[model samples]
Target: MTNSLKNLTSILLLLFLAPIVIATIQTPLVTQTQLPEEKKKEETPIVYAAQLESSPIATEITEPKKAFVYFTHYQEAYQPILAAKGEKVAVYHPESNITTFQEQINAQFAFHQVETEFLENYNKQEIKEYNTIRPFVLNALGHNKYDIILDIHRDSMKADVTTLKVGEESYAKFIFVIGGEHENYRWNEQLANNLSDQLNKLVPGISRGVLVKSGKGVDGVYNQDLAKNLLVVELGGVDNNEQEINRSIAILAKAISNMFFQPIAS
Candidate 1:
C-alpha cells in the first residue's frame, strides 16, 4: 500500500494504545505498599476528645457565716392602743414571740443565742437602751466574733406601707436602716444592700431598700458603730401580725444564709 495509508494506520494504532500505555506506567506508583510511617499518619482521620470523665464536678453549696440577732426595742410593742406608765407596752411584744427568727437562723446558720430582753423601755430614754445593749453585744463579741449583727425592730408605719406579696404568701416587707454616723457605715451599707438584693430576688418587694438615719428625732448611730455588719432591720410595721412577721423572718433567714454562703468551683 501507499506510504500515506500506512502512516494513517500507524497513527490510529498509537491513539488506541495510548491509554493502556499510560495506565501501565502509573500502575506501580499507585500499587506501591511501602509508604513512610509519618506519611501514613498524616493521611489518617483525626479523632479528638477530652479525657474529663475522671475529673470531679463542682457543687454550688457553701457554709454559712456566724451571725447574731437581738431586739433593742424588746418591749416596744406594735400598734400601741394606750400609753403605759413609761413601760413602753403596746399591742404586740416582738421580744416575747419573734425570737423565733433567731431560732430559725440557728437551724441553718452559725447564730449566737443572744435573745436579750430589757424589762424597762431603754429605747425611750435618749441612748439608754443602746448603751445597755452595746455592752451585752460587746460581751457577746468577746465570746464570739460574729460576722453579722442584726438589731431587729418593727416599724411604726401602716400595713399598706410595709406589706408585700410573694407568690402565694403575703409577707410584711422590711427595710434596712443604716446609721451613717459610724466610721464603718459603708461596710454596713454593703451588707444591707446585699441582703436587700437577695431578699428581693426571693420575694420581690419584700425589701423596702436601705434607709439612712442620723441627727435629730432619731438615734443616728443606733449602736451600729460596734460592728461593720450591724444592721437595724425594721420588720413590717404596727399593722403586721405575728404570722406575717414570722413569714418575713423565714425569708430573711434564707436571704441571710445565701449572702454568707458562697459556692466555689472545684
Candidate 2:
C-alpha cells in the first residue's frame, strides 16, 4: 500500500460518485419539465389571456343611468301673443294658459314605461315664479337619487328662432342650460354637451347648444348642485304650440332612450 497507489484509488472513486451526484441533482429538473400544462399554469404567477380578458377591471363600459324630469315653474305656459302673425308683435304678454307641461311630457312619451320618474307637484299659484321652486326641487332631490334632473321649461324665445324642421313635422329646437355655480359644474356641462351632441345628431339644428350661466339675472346654481348631471332644458319658445311641443317631446324621449338604455355591443 504505497502513498501514490492510495491517492489514485481515491481520485477514481471521487470521479465515479460525482456523476451519480449530478444525476441525482438533475432528477427534479426533469420532473418539473415533465409536469402537466395545467399544473404548470397553476404554479406560475403569470395571468392567462382568458383570465385577463374576463377581469372586472378590464371590462367594457357600463350603461347610462336613469333620469328624472320635473318642472320647477309648473305654470310657465306659452304666451299666445308671440304666435300672432305680422311683424312678430312683441306686446306685453301676460296670459298664463292652463295646459300643464308636466302632463304633456308624461302623455306624449312612453317615459312612464322606462326608468324615468316625473315630479308632478302642479299648482299655478304655488310654484308660480322661478325663485319659488327651490324648496320643491330640493325636496325631490332629498327623497330620490337621480343620474339626471331635467328642469323642463318653455323659453321666451320667438317661435321662428326656436323652431327646427326634422323630417316632415316641425320641432321646437331646445337648449341645454347648465349651471356654473356648482363644484361639479364641469360634470353638468359635460352631460349637457353629451346630450346636445346626441340631439344634434338626430336633428342637425335641434339643439341650440349648451348655455352655461352664473351670477346675477340667473338663479345661478338652478339647484344643479344636487346632482352631477342636472340640466335645465328650454323645450320651445312662448309661441310654439302644444303640437310642436309634443313633437319635440317625442324626439327628446327617443334621444334620451338611446343615450341611456342603448346597449353596448359585446
Tens digits of per-residue lDDT, candidate 2, 68-90, equal 78766554566553453222344
The true-versus-predicted C-alpha distance at residue 157 of model 1, in Å, is 0.7
Top candidate (TM-score): 2
TM-scores vs. true structure, each candidate? 0.61, 0.63
lDDT of 1 by residue, 1-266 (tens): 69999999999999999999999887856434666766898855332111111211222333435566777766545542223224354645534434434444443332212222222323433333776678777767667667678888778888789887544456788899998887888888988999998888767778999998888887778878888878899888876655566566666766776665645337
Q: Against the true structure, candidate 2 has what lDDT?
A: 0.66
Q: The CA-based lDDT of model 1 is what?
A: 0.65
Candidate 2 lowest-lDDT run of ten: 47-56
Least well predicted 10-residue stretch by lDDT in candidate 1: 47-56
lDDT of each: 0.65, 0.66
| Predicted structure 1, TM vs. truth | 0.61
Clashing pairs in 2: none
Mark the regions of model 1 whose C-alpha exceeds 4 Å error after superposition: 1-64, 78-105, 108-128, 263-266
